[model samples]
Target chain A: MDADKHFIVGVFDDEEVLLKGIGKIRGNGVKIHDVYSPFPVHGIDDALSIKRSRLPIAAFMFGMTGTALALLMQIWMLGYDWPMIIGGKNHASLPPFIPVTFELTVLLAALGMVGTFFIASDMKPYKWPRQFDLRSTEDKHVMAIDLAINSGKTKDELRSLLRDSGASEVNEKSFE
Target chain B: MQVASSLREALITGGKTVKDVSHDISRHVENKPTKLWWAAMAISVAVMAYGFYCLCYLLWEGVGVWGLNKTVGWAWDITNFVWWVGIGHAGTLISAILLLFRQRWRMSINRAAEAMTIFAVICAATFPFAHMGRLWLGFYWVFPLPNTWGSLWANFNSPLLWDVFAISTYFTVSLVFWYMGLIPDFAVIRDRAVVQGAKIRAQVYNALSFGWQGGAKTWMRYESVALILAGLSTPLVLSVHTIVSMDFATSVIPGWHTTIFPPYFVAGAIFSGFAMVLTLLLITRKVFKLEDYITIYHIELMNIIIIITGSIVGIAYITELFIAWYSGVEYEGYAFYNRVSGPFAWSYWSMMTCNVISPQLFWVKKIRTSLVATFVLSIVVNIGMWFERFVIIVTSLHRDYIPSSWTMFSPTMYDIGEYLFTFGFFFTAFLLFAKFFPVINMAEVKSIVKVASLEKKENASH
Candidate 1:
């Protein structure tokens, strides 16, 4: 592993219980490393106070880029380079340009946004991720709290806090 | 939190927990392939092999091996192309369009629909590529790449060129959107594999999943990107079939030159698309024992869409006929007349019955909800849509302005083989998808597990 961290992880079977537990844990001002759920639990993001994403803005910019590139390529090709008069239609026209323009616009937007998402999520193909709890991907939701960052509470205190809040299992996890 | 209410139906039934949803959906992936899976795959490969043989012979013997003649240039190949493209449309509509609309019922079906979209596009693309006798050069020529022939650019005005761009764009977008949706679910499967001590499965799914940490921050971005992609794909879906329709509508041919082709083709695309989805889902649901997730509610909702689109197609057909007679052009009028009374009258009636009359059966509650009825009608609708394309392409061309060049088309064995080959290819790909990946969008299904209304009720009661 390129990086390592010590963490206290809590696993909960029920989403409702998990939500309540998240609220309780976050209420104490304990910094949460991350919570992994099999599904996107409603209100979990708000509970964790995660920041709103800026991906939509990225998508718009990418889309604009696509539109500009499409128009530029078409104008360069049809208007200046190898312009032909077929069926008496205009060599550099607007209607015929729309389809290709639309296609390129969509293609670039999709590709660009996906690229942006991978960057934003730190979801590179080569990165080896640390797993806090394997069951987090199965039936349980996992909440991992970094032990090294929190100086106020002892490990036992956080472990009891996890147990009191309905965690099925509270375990210490480390990635080396 | 969601209770199955009269007004707001639960998207997933059996009141499944998130784990149960994961387990239920992932069971197929973790276990070895079933006997039925093997049998179906075997048949698909055999059919595909035959189709491949036909394609090889086509390459060897040339385009003349098919029944295409001077007058009727585009026949079974283009018709199959359009048919398959139309089938691909329902997938995007289910995923992108329905997502935009917030139709929760799409959760269970969207995965299969999107997969169908990819496979169907693959099938649809084979025609135009193979139709080019010089498949090698013609494929490259269709693209607007700058080459040694620097001054020679692809004709911007050509619908075929537009189609080349449209199909590829549609394929790429759909692939991204579908794969993006799969990432989180892949992580879920990966976690399970690790627990089971399956080293290879864990590593493969781990990499495949992009090491998704399920962080709230990551999910938010995943969601935002999904919405944006959906927005991009919605217009894209409409444009794709519209460009396909333009291949005919832009022409001077009597039956083909109609302003209504875009909406008509789009409507028919959705119609056949839903039918094909239904056809496949019915088999998939039963074979996989996924009745709880893919409930009658989902089937009926899809059936309702089929009815609506089918009627739109029917109205378009009548409207085209009305315009043909209403337009006083002899060529257009005779073209409509020829479709009804030509050598292809059977194809025309089949189109009418399958596309129009048959889907009307879906209007009935019992028939629409009935699995057998939906399955048969779905296949029937597809057959109708195919013949509909045949009637439009062949009828107009067989007896156009130049009567001397008018000729009836009869498909050679290779044409039938090529069409069967697509069926083989489509099923083989789809079955492999079903076997390997989570068929239902597990993450999405988990999202809808708690109904908003039920949550509201619980809060109020509290």
Candidate 2:
């Protein structure tokens, strides 16, 4: 279980209303904890002010590793380990290495990116996710605002902000 | 007719809300097994059992049980391998390529296509296994692993080795792409299970979903990963079949040698792959009642690709003939001549008609748009592609360089049995997958619906 934290959760019936609610609430300087939607709402990340993911840099680094490893593995195995000339071609030919090199590059890139993603997202097999709203997956979008972030605001003030900003219902949420 | 054609054609028919999309797609997995599911499963199992018996008998009897001799070592087995592998190309084309192109229509169909790629690859894999008659040590011998034998290594020179690496890598990548895409949909189901008060269901789906919170940060990461994977797989789809083509082109076996094979094989692979997708989806769309999700637009667009690739394949076929004649090499000339007017002329003509001539009918708007016509043509195209492989493998090999060894080759019951084994394995695996997982890409589908919904909202506000 994660460290318990108090959250002001707003449930929304529609994505448009949710988007507008996010804008109004953010304009009022209330920090958002997280928004959960059944689907990826277009422009929601911009609305949430989330930084763009750095996954491509990770993918490129992994791909280079794979390329370097593939070349070394092939050269070492064929040229140094036990050189044998088949079909009158050189043992360490560049032409033949391209296919294997390409494959290893792709394999490492895909695996590394997924591994990085799982780690970055803090997805552990043992940890259960805090479910803010059961309807979040089915149809509704749920936005949770952390109360601890805005110490100046009381619970009532945040609740009213949620309601005025198009929250169908405002409820207190806690996560372990 | 023109007015009817001009009628607003949305990729998604039947106005469905975001919730409806989730409910409709997830119901297959969340609900009880329908009788159709049971019937299909029972039939698939029965066929699979028979196929399993065939494999066991094949192992017991050895490779000799199939029709193989000095002349034709690769006939039905490799043909089936190439065919199944080719059939799998459409899945990647639909998922990765379409995604890269920003085709919104791809959203609804990609899940099933990616699943098809996995299943088809699985089916393709059996041929290699069957080719390894000594199944126990076959893996150790063929697979490149450090052995106790001094200075032992697989031949990097061999295209076969390249194939081993390519197919395995393709399988791994496609699998990651497919499973990663499933995470969000699985989360959707998990949340639904929670609401239904099904504790066991919720717990199971949550574990499967990897604690997906559907946060904006997660979605951003999710979208980026999908794009990168699509980029990775696009080259993969092309490379795999190119390497497969090299298996023939690298050889000097008369008809086997050609510069045209890589692009030719790639086109043929996509051509056959789309046909297989259409064949399966036509039945699946009806059975699952997913007409709205898998609309006529999707079907027609796929058919247009078929026509284009089919034309490319047709040109390749002609080029092969022209080159064989122009080279003036006796073996190559005889190879092409023998195909058109040889012992296996029936198979050659079948290939031409099915692969080339029939698909041209798609130029007619009505023919391509008709579901029944599309279904029938899809099957026809598959048969044509199967014959195309047979023509390449068997026809080429049946007549050897040495006149004395030249002989006819045909599939024994074991060969048919081996093929049936893959069909059973593929369908059984797919049917179970359909029942257990979100058959539609719920998240992607919802994005499209979400956009449409937003547009509707703006109109109302104005």
lDDT of 1 by residue, B1-462 (tens): 334454665566665766688889999999999999999999999999999999988988888888899888999999999999999999999999999998888989999999999999999999988888788788558987767787588887899999999999999999999999999888888888887899888888888889887876787778888999999999999999999999999999999999999999999999999999999999999999999899998999999999999999999999999999998998999999999988899999999999899989988999988999999999999999999999999998999587788789999999999999999999999999999999999888887765633554565688
How many clashing pairs per prediction, in order? 0, 1
TM-score of chain B of each: 0.97, 0.96
Candidate 1 lDDT by residue in tens digits, A1-176: 12238888998877789889988987887888888877777677788887788887777788889889888888888888888887888878888888998899889888998998998778865565788877776667888988887757899999999999899999999876
In order, the candidates keep a fraction of the true contacts of 0.78, 0.75
Give the 10-residue window scoring lowest on summed lDDT in candidate 1 chain B.
Answer: B1-10
- Tens-digit lDDT string for candidate 2 (B1-462): 001122335656676898889988988888899999899999998888898898899899899989888899999999999999999999999999998988777888888988999999999998888789988876666566887786488877789989998999999999999999999888888888877888888888888889988887888898899999999999999999999999999999888899999999999999999998898889889988999889988899999999999999999999999999899998999999999999999999999999999999999999999999999999999999999999999999988888899899988888998899899899999999999999998887876775555445555688
The deviation in Å at residue B98 for candidate 2 is 0.5
What docking tier does model 1 reach?
Answer: medium
Q: After superposition, how far is residue B362 of candidate 1 from its true place, in Å?
A: 1.5
Worst 10 residues of 1 chain A by lDDT: A1-10
lDDT for B166 (candidate 2): 95
| Best-performing candidate as measured by DockQ | 1
State the displacement of the C-alpha of residue B224, model 1, in Å, after optimal TM-score superposition: 0.7
